[model samples]
Target: MRMLRYCSLLALVAALAACSSVPGGGPVSQTKGEYKVGNPYKVAGKVYVPKADPHYVAEGMASWYGPKFHGRKTANGETFNMNALTAAHTTLPMPSYVRVTNLENGRNLILKVNDRGPFVGDRLIDVSRRSAQLLGFEKQGVTRVRVEAVPGPNARPATVFARNTPAPATSPVEQKKAPIVVASARPAPVFTPEPAKKDEVVVQPLEAEPDSPATASENIYVQIGAFSDKLRAKMVADDIRHVGQTLLELVDINGQKLYRVRIGPLPSKARADETLGRALAWGHNTARIVLD
Candidate 1:
């Protein structure tokens, strides 16, 4: 009877403690985070400056983190929860919100940004595992996505749909939906005669016409962009050739032709990462690695 009473008393004390802290069981975080625009920092040879931009938007690959990152400290000072609808971005201010739309599946969701990451490749964002599932790309691991900032840090999720995605050719052009300002990472000077600055590197434009590429080769390539227009593809290839060996190729997708600008056949994944960082820092938002 003494042991039973002691157990009951412990339970009662725990309930009272919870009530005192939360007041009617209100929602709260164990480690609350805050809104912050962090300083410029370098990772893997890439420098990123975090700042508040209401017009931030870009198109790129989106990956997810769960088991490895769960219960960690987020950049915003909050405890990371893989089950929560949170994300990590390269340059966006912490504790901000964005609408992430999977370009392949048309899965759109408004998620909170609370950490800094995805320092891997040219990936644009690292979403929580739950966000991946809700966005309908958890099974595939990664998906092409268009992410745009939305106002109101307290914004709630709305209007989710994942099966209505468009074709690859049309999705790139769909980036014209407007109200987007690229991150602070401005494009590098490609054709400048002046010496490269201490903080900036000059990329060279492609001077010669690249032949049709071997897309099925076992080599690796960094896809700079895909365009429905051949001229735009060639222009992008010329514009960002200094990123690496540039290649411009056209291929038919379901009877539709897409001009793909890429930097290719890198010697190793480490070189690929450096190239990706350079591409991202140079403001190529859609850049990502792919097998040739």
Candidate 2:
């Protein structure tokens, strides 16, 4: 009888160890707890943790997904539609909804966080192709934006299958929420181009023709205008400076001493134009496009 009891105890211990040894294994109940999907997911080099009440409000660079993942399975097993007003988040529940705003242009977009990533630096979320376009990132390719969780019913299925089925389009009223209008129909503009003139054509005397047109990371810079109050300038700067890349500089443009905010080392004029457009959508009409 003593031997039988010892054997039973040993068997129980082995079973417990096996259960814990399973990858991403955790407590298992018939009705799982919040985010019972599995342990955190490891992809590329980053680990993504799912949260039940993962309400995140962050400011960072916003990018978009396109042909690369049009019909691929999202983190929640849903079919990713680049055109949908959906987004990818690292931790928010599979079907959680979010509101992304371009503080610079006052553009806002509501998106469903059914996927994961932007995983490049301090970026918080990656919006869908349509969402990014609506947020004015289609042309610029990337922009600084704010993301906030919005309350919603969690009844929506977490995954979508890309059959011939199509999701309903966002209504005009819904689109209005996005202050910046990006053209989704057009492909991303080509940034690289041949030099305009092979040899230096001096339009101005001794004006050192810029050594090769500015590359996207070298030439384009932004200048923010001043407000009647210093507080306002700081407020706008705080909103626009989502990425550490953007810097606030105090300078005079056209004899007006203003609190100038600038970003980049953008390489070319085309890139500068694209970035300027995004700044406009962010509501910085006075923001200047400069080459430095």
Candidate 3:
């Protein structure tokens, strides 16, 4: 009986050691400074407010970071592992749970938002390399995606959108070719507006040309603005319309209404590039190209 008890204790010790060898194993201890609701901070001239509420949703471009950021201390005081399912956001509270869906493909993933970054433009989130791989966008550095925060206890369920279906296969003959350089017969007008002053809207009128006919083929758009107020979005759309045709879309994000202003169903990438350049010259620097 004594021998048997000694063997059992040895087996227990071996099992505990094995468990400790696993990643994220060993004695579970709260990370120092984790789960903090940070105060508003500024990055690249934009202010970001970090609050603790879990009901948040947004849609925009998502890019992934790997080697350069791997093993670094994240915003939540935890080490960032590129292989782990983690992400970064500009405003959401650190250590929050989010559901990210790739709009191009129907892939979806759940990630822990532990860092803060991708603060260049209008990008919504920056995911880890593994998250991007699982979402089927690893090859492409960036892709369009929708992100929704997972609610905590007693919070309402997030609004889910139907997944986009794959487009029908096209024959080789019908396949669209890559955009070629097309010299404009007339010099595209260069509209340079003064830098916007605080609390002031920059509006410079361009020569109003005839609106282009809507195309049935798949086209791209450059999204310029998203606002909770419909009137505000319309006003921005009107400003953009001074340059070219515009489209307004109402999107529901986390049970909140958002009005999005977009320009064009541009026929080709070259045209899209030209339009984007013109918009940037006009001081609409946040405009991003989107597929329609």
Name model 2 segments beyond 4 Å from true.
Answer: 1-38, 153-292
How far residue 65's Cα lies from its native spot in candidate 1, in Å, is: 0.3
Please name the candidate that would achieve the greatest lDDT relative to the true structure. Answer: 1
| TM-scores for the candidates | 0.45, 0.40, 0.43
Winner by TM-score between candidate 3 and candidate 1 = 1
**Worst ten-residue run, lDDT, model 3?**
180-189
Top candidate by TM-score = 1
TM-score of 1: 0.45
lDDT of each: 0.65, 0.54, 0.63
The deviation in Å at residue 144 for candidate 2 is 1.2
- The 10 consecutive residues of candidate 1 with the worst lDDT sum are 177-186
Regions more than 4 Å wrong, model 3: 1-33, 152-292
Instruction: Report how far residue 193 has shifted in candidate 1, in Å.
Output: 65
lDDT tens per residue, model 3, 203-254: 3232222234335654577667556666777666765664457777665444
Q: Write the per-residue lDDT of candidate 1 for residues 71-102, one digit (tens) a residue.
A: 98998789998866689998887777788888
TM-score of 3: 0.43
